[model samples]
Target: MTTWVLLRGLAREARHWGGFPDKLRCALPAGDTVVALDLPGNGALWRERSPARVEDMVAAARRTLAGVPHTPPYALVALSLGGMVALQWALEHREEVRGCVLINSSLGRFSPFWRRLRPASYATLLRLLAPGRAAIDRERAILRLTSNLPLAEGTQQAWTAYALEAPVSRGNALRQLKAAALFRAPAAAPGVPLLLVASERDRLVSVECSRAMARHWGAPLRVHPAAGHDLALDDPGWLAGLVADWKTRVS
Candidate 1:
């Protein structure tokens, strides 16, 4: 049985994983466990100042995981900025990380700035960073950029409530962005089995970036036909199946 530590992207809390965590847990082999930990300055820790570097974020993640009763050789399943943190963690703590599954994530060393962040979303990202925006509007904009699914009214309402309940400060948001932009993955991939899952139609980050990284690492790359950046949101079952299959092959 393995300990699967799940991580989310900027300003997104563990709750943002929606039903995916449950799905993955059910799909995993017997006795395996899934745990989602909030990065500093998001969700339960919204008041904390987020670090401006991915390495520090990795340290924060390690601290959060210290309390979980999990065994070593942990499997890391992380998306976007969380994937960046996972990469750094795997590189620095090879003894603890067994393997990594990165979803729609980009590293500065492999991708150009425009590809790491699509130029088309520049205005949307800037608007998301603006101060004093209503919670509902901000969440709606985020949904638009992250998922291809037509959000149900209930989903939007729920996200609005989540955002209002645990608002991320503008400062923390900027710090997270800085951390992502500054993160530079090593030229060589981490010394662990890796699986790369990406959305071919991702708008926030280019799919080519994932393809390039997979090529560099000689890791298997699975492409979703139409999902956006939030591949889990768009197709949870498919994501789970792919992950389960990868686990089987690795095991």
Candidate 2:
């Protein structure tokens, strides 16, 4: 049996996976188990302060995985900040990871501009958008940035509700921004097969970032034309199918 571990991006909880887990499980062949973890400051760990550094988050992830019943050599699928963490983990614990998939993420060394401005700009933006109303508006703005799919009224409302409920503190958000800004993949990636997924419409992290990583790592690259930064949320079925296919190919 194979084990797959999922990691989510900034300010997002495991619930942010939406229906992707179930969808992936259905699409996956039998004898595979899926585990979606809440990063230190989000989801099930929302009450905790966001970690101050990527290493801190990585430690938390290691501890979480250690508690899981599965043995070593798990497949890792990560998005955005989660992708960065996954890359670092694969580098540090190469022998324990079987395969990796990164989505809408970048290596810190790739984009000089983003690396420079991310900390300050993200901090400012978080402060400016920390209120519940501001968070709702940010969600709308995010919807605009990534998706052309006309979001159903009920779906939008539900997203709005979740946004309001999971409002991130400015300080914690800043910490996450700092972690993202500072993260860099190791000089060489793990030897395991890797899949890099990019969204053509992602405004947060450009497709070029993913492309560069894929080129550097010699990993397979996949792109989705219409999906945005929140590809999993925007199209869980598509993302799940891709994950299942990647699992099969890598296995």
On TM-score, the candidate that comes out on top is 1
lDDT of each: 0.89, 0.77
Runs in model 2 lying further than 4 Å from the true structure:
115-129
Residue 157's C-alpha lDDT in candidate 1?
A: 81
Q: 131-199, model 1: which lDDT tens digit per residue?
A: 554777778888898899765347778877778788888889899999999998878989999999999
Question: In model 1, which runs have C-alpha deviations exceeding 4 angstroms?
Answer: 131-133
User: In model 2, what is the error at residue 105, expressed in angstroms?
Assistant: 0.5
TM-score per candidate = 0.96, 0.88
